[model samples]
Target: MNNSSKAVVSFIVGAAVGVAVGYFLNSDKKDELVGKLRYQADKLKDKWKKKKDQFEDALENELA
Candidate 1:
């Protein structure tokens, strides 16, 4: 809670972030990981769209 403690924590976090960025930038599998992440995002979008459509249909049925 002190200023000195806060400074130390900030330094540690900055170091960790620098290390992570360096690793990702130097990693050979970065592209592969990105592709997988993108694929997962697309699948999630499709799933949400399907759920929304189903919810809308049910709502219309109830109102009818």
Candidate 2:
């Protein structure tokens, strides 16, 4: 898939997984659950950031 399509899929999948994890951990070990969710979120954030930077660099190179 294209980069944009891949990014969207990644976000949607990450959100769904986060929601499921939250639902399952709503009752017990809330702190642990939140930590796990945060970790996953950070990972996704990093992935998106990298992709965005790559796209920006390519655009800049094309414009130069």
Candidate 2 lDDT, tens digit per residue, 1-64? 9999999999999999999888777767788878999999999999999999999999999999
lDDT of 2 at 29: 79
Worst 10 residues of 2 by lDDT: 24-33
lDDT of 1 by residue, 1-64 (tens): 9999999999999999999999998899899999999999999999999999999999999999
Query: TM-score for all predictions?
Result: 0.77, 0.56
Off by more than 4 A, model 2: 1-28
Please, what is the whole-model Cα lDDT of each candidate in the order they appear?
Answer: 0.98, 0.94
Give the deviation of candidate 1 from the true structure as CA RMSD. 1.9
The per-residue C-alpha lDDT of model 2 at residue 19 equals: 94
* Clash number by candidate, in order: 0, 0
